[model samples]
Structure formats: structure tokens, C-alpha cells
Target: MTTVAAELWDGPASEPVLTTVRVPVPCVARPGTTLWHLDGPCRCFVGGPPPEFAPSTARG
Candidate 1:
């Protein structure tokens, strides 16, 4: 588990407040690192970004 400070992106410039978030082990991955999840192996970027992977194509 990891604790991180996250900012709320609601409305224009007010006092910036950070929220503490605890991410479960499986859900957390290093930036630009590859790991196997329920969706197979993929390269994880950072912070709510989608993972990058190539779909497997069967050959006849």
C-alpha cells in the first residue's frame, strides 16, 4: 500500500488542497514499468493513465 497526496481538480484557482490516497498493491505500479494485471501484461504510466500493450493476435 502507498499513500499519496492528490489534488482536487474542481473549479478555478482556489487554495490548493491535497487529499491523501492509499492505493492497493495490485493497483499501484511504477512509472513506465510493466506488470501483469487482470488485463494481462502492460506498461503502466502514472496517475490514472491507461496502460499500454499490444493485443495478441492468433496466427493460422
Candidate 2:
């Protein structure tokens, strides 16, 4: 999996924080990253922005 450069901007302006991270690239609608939850690991995300990908129609 290709490592993806990412960041998380959270909180107010004065306390705005960004989490710079490297995650495996995700599928068109499924990112290759997951959140470690107390009740086992999870990968289902809704709002995380997806990366750019070359669609099949665009691929040679």
C-alpha cells in the first residue's frame, strides 16, 4: 500500500491542532487507514477526505 501524507485539523483557531500522519492509500471509497477503538480496531469512516485515484476508465 502506498503511504499517504495526511493531517487532522481540529479544535478552535487558538488551539487548532493538526495530526500529520502517513497512511496506506485507500480504495476509491475506502481508505486504507483505521481507528483503534477500545472495542477492537475499526476502519469504517464517513467524513475523512479520500485521496485522488486514477479511475479504471482513465487507466490505460
Candidate 3:
């Protein structure tokens, strides 16, 4: 488990507030030469803004 600070809005009229959320870290496994699997797909949550609302970042 990992805790991260995030901004969340309760309602449309409410201002966004900073809060701490517990996110489960994903576990990955690769078996042999051709098998790859994610062990916790159900425990995953999207941790960032949607792609349409994401801020631009510089990539090099």
C-alpha cells in the first residue's frame, strides 16, 4: 500500500481539497519467456487526472 496526496472535489459547488489516499501497488510477474501477468487488476485505481484534463509535461 502507498499513500499519495491528491486533490478531490466533493461536489460541483465545492472547492477541491487535498487528501491522502491509499493506493495498492501493482504486482507484476513474468514467467518463462512468453508469459506476463498482472496479479491485482481489481485493486487498481486510476491515480491521476483523465488524459483530457492532464497537464502537459516535457518529455526528452
- List the global CA lDDT of all models: 0.41, 0.45, 0.32
Backbone steric clashes in candidate 1, count: 0
Task: Please estimate how well model 1 matches the true structure, expressed as its whole-model Cα lDDT.
Answer: 0.41
Deviating ranges (above 4 Å) for candidate 1: 1-12, 26-60
> Candidates sorted by TM-score, descending order?
2, 1, 3
TM-scores across all candidates? 0.23, 0.29, 0.20
Residue-level lDDT tens digits of model 3 in 4-57: 344566555565555544333232221222221122222223443211212336
Model 2 spans > 4 angstroms off: 25-60
Rank by lDDT (best first): 2, 1, 3
Clashes in model 1: which pairs?
Answer: none
Q: How many backbone clashes does candidate 3 have?
A: 0
RMSD of 3: 10.6
> Whole-model lDDT for model 3 versus the true structure?
0.32
User: Whose lDDT is higher: candidate 1's or candidate 2's?
Assistant: 2
Error of 2 at 18 (Å): 1.1
- Top TM-score hit: 2
